[model samples]
Target: MKSVNFKKKLTRLFFVLLGVTLVYQTGRTFFLKQEWQARNCAYEMVKLLFPDAWDRACDQYGLFCFNGSEKPMQKCTGVVESGSIILIHGLDEPGLIFEPLALALHRKGYLVLFFFYPDDQRIDASSRLLFNNLSSLSLAGPVVLVGHSMGGLVARHMLVDPVIDYAGARARTKVPEISDLIMVGTPNHGAFLSRFRLFMEIREQCLLASDHRWHRLSGFIDGTGAAGIDLLPQSEFMRHLNSLPYPGDVHCHMIAGHIFPFPVNMPEQFQMTGNQTLEGLLLSEKNYFLSVLGKAGLLIGDGLVSINSSVPFNVPVTLVKGNHKTMLANCFSGSSRIPPAIPVILDILEL
Candidate 1:
């Protein structure tokens, strides 16, 4: 009789959870489609910030270049301005996604160098371009690197593996000394969702659709590009990147969010050390797909990245209560709440 009663409760709980997952997925799918299908607005934002850069926008491959007062695509011969902050965006993101954050830093008197890269370039390739670009900057002062998602991967490579020259691409000069590394919702480990077969296929195509030829001819990076390959669970790039320890010479601060509202009453997978609060990181549902995937000892994280993935092996983790996207979106006016990371970064950098 007790077993029967317990099963009934379990069944009720399952339906409640199912309703929550469905609602979240419905909104999530709409958001994903909106991001991928939306037209690129890179130029408009740049023009809004610097009216002079408006005409130069058309010349740039995308909409705008952050070379700062320099003509598009021309060699940036300017000295690296002091109090400069380099911002790199994550996968399926544009430099403008960081507008709010940049505005906040600007108010604090920072010269923001926003970097834009292909949506699907591998870490190795992305880092190579970054290395080449930074090598030429000839910085006049120390700089802080702020990376979101895969952006952290590029910054990490700069710290521990600057010599990676993919496709025979090499750094012409040494990258400037990095004072601090700040990562928000970065997947130091691969995301579990990247392993999903259907999601993988769709993501691969969306990545491929971003090509100039694709746009002009009406076309994208699959998940196997120089960058996408690294996002998969336990992929070769992840293993390689994680193999290197966090550089002791530089301090890296991290921030992440948990999606679920309830924690103490959640599933077994949501459990944390010493029954720690899972408020900042845990998925809401544990359906068949989650159950099958959870068997590999998967964890509850910010819905996109597992906590095990966000919390670097040796580096510290600061849990910010939110989701994967919102944690780094403190800069967005619509984002409303201030991201926990912004304060941490400002404090560390003494800004």
Candidate 2:
């Protein structure tokens, strides 16, 4: 009789937990959807009221040229002596990722240009836009392309796709001369985090919404966006891109980051001892859950991209000490320190 009663109570408890979970998930989804709708509405309003200002905003999707100054303008202002360097930003970036690097290159007398696009769109679409914009620019001398993350794939598409050639031929404009290409923290194979792109999109939106009056909107809770789908490891886009060969005319280089430092000098016995200790700790029922979490950090290089994924084609690569974002520049903290990859890039540019 006691056993029967216990079974009944357990079943009741399970149902109760399930009901609570379902309610919580449903509420969270509804909140996130509402927040997304509100954000879109606010964006439309600002875009309608301040058309010119909105166009010039870094957050907007467009190509901009900066001549030594931090302020970007439609046209290049000064003399082009050291040639032009176009900086292509990564997925969901608001065009500010290149600030530190752009300024550095500008100081070195390079004509710096920034290409911004709706990162949620298809990669080929963004590539075509970049190619079209470059065709419009009357740049003198060699042009170097520096791409970060997904930007690298965009650059590759521009270089590899026959469609670009067809467009240029039809337009009767010579394709822009690309002398060098530098890919920074690019997931050439694929990114593991891309599987969680919806979560990432929500996080980014929340950060953006935090700046506006709708900041509280994000307190509620996310892109099955085409670009996110393309970024998957086994996606058709990845297969197509990998099949193509990069142009031999342009010199290419990759910069990868290693956030975790593995012990190199430790004795084998010491290593074994450490592993045993870790195993003992992790074998406990309470701490067993942490094992996967710890392994994930080690496997997920620089938090987002694995080292193997960072390099696909056979090219010279420089490994730096920092995570994906930090290797380029500290987006937060005002980027006070010079990033590790900056010096390597400068060396490659011979600036």
Candidate 3:
């Protein structure tokens, strides 16, 4: 036992020293990028050199990102059966943000894996990351995929888009067999906020740059990465993504948040709290995309995504109370998952 402990200590020390050396050598290159980009690159480097540097990295970025595959099965929630459920987070958020939901599902008995992707890159790239990692996991039984916000778009490309088949002419890979797919607060029809041409243009330059995706994204209000950019209403990326039929044999379900009121909806019908309700209507009524009220006054979305954008065609969606940012309390922020959504998600697992 002493020998094993000694070996572990030595290994940790060696990595620490190696990390310092690499940082010393590449610190200049890492420093030159934008603040967020620098932090992102540094985090990736530390992740490779030091196994336990995640907390520090996560703090700087304010996202939940940990792969729980190696955790002891006994400690996992919902251990009733032997199956896996992959959780993908929405735009600019981390996978681990689903802690509340994941734990609840785990108690019900499924091995949950939180999948994280680089927000700075394209949706296709994110999807590729998810598929590639999933291919390596040796598991038995059907796998359920749950994506929140922008994550749902990523999952769609991964399992539903035939064009994005992660196979090349030289080497073909097996498409992941998905049993069911659940999207929470996903913008299936695209969001109105991303429709602004100026913001979209600026985002394009930032995300498509050759050097790094995060280079010029500073100062934009919750500016999205490549996938987020694609979620723009009427954008070409969205058009192509939606052009294809929903692929695979996976069962699909959706969850939409309606805690906030918008301009086009019947004000009295929407459940609203606080003084911001009237403000929401005024702002949304003037929004270029949302300005025109529907025959039934337009109801604004859960702060960010409108109800129309959240609901996907032909997919059954459970409407819950809460705004976009409050749906899943993140690691950095102590906000907890909205209580009402829990049972709905749990019910999906049984389906």
Q: Give the top-scoring candidate (TM-score).
A: 2
lDDT of 1 by residue, 1-351 (tens): 999999999999999988987686455444442432232233233346555443342233221225333233333455766677888877655444565676668778777777655545456666766766676666656778888877888778766773653212223335566678888778887775643334544543354354322222111321123344467654666788878777776777777666654343334222234344433345545575554444333365577776567766445566666676766564355657776567666776793
Winning model by lDDT: 2
Query: Which is the better candidate, 1 or 2, if ranked by TM-score?
Result: 2
lDDT of 3 by residue, 238-309 (tens): 787778766546688877766644343433223333343333533334455555544122246676777767
- Shift of residue 10 alpha carbon in model 1, Å: 33
lDDT of 2 by residue, 1-351 (tens): 999999999999999988986686456444544544454455456557666554444244446777665343564433444477888987765456677888888788777888867666567778887877766556667789999988999998888888776235434645557889999989888775764555656656654555341232222211124565566666667888888876777798888777765322212111112124322323333454465554453366577887657755456667777897888788585647899888888998994
Taking all chains together, each candidate's TM-score versus the true structure is 0.62, 0.67, 0.58
Q: TM-score of model 1 relative to the true fold?
A: 0.62
Off by over 4 Å in 3: 1-81, 166-176, 194-224, 261-299, 330-338
Residue 266 of model 3: what lDDT?
36
Model 1 poorest 10 in a row by lDDT = 214-223
Of the candidates numbered 2 and 3, which has the greater TM-score value? 2
Q: Please estimate how well model 3 matches the true structure, expressed as its whole-model Cα lDDT.
A: 0.58
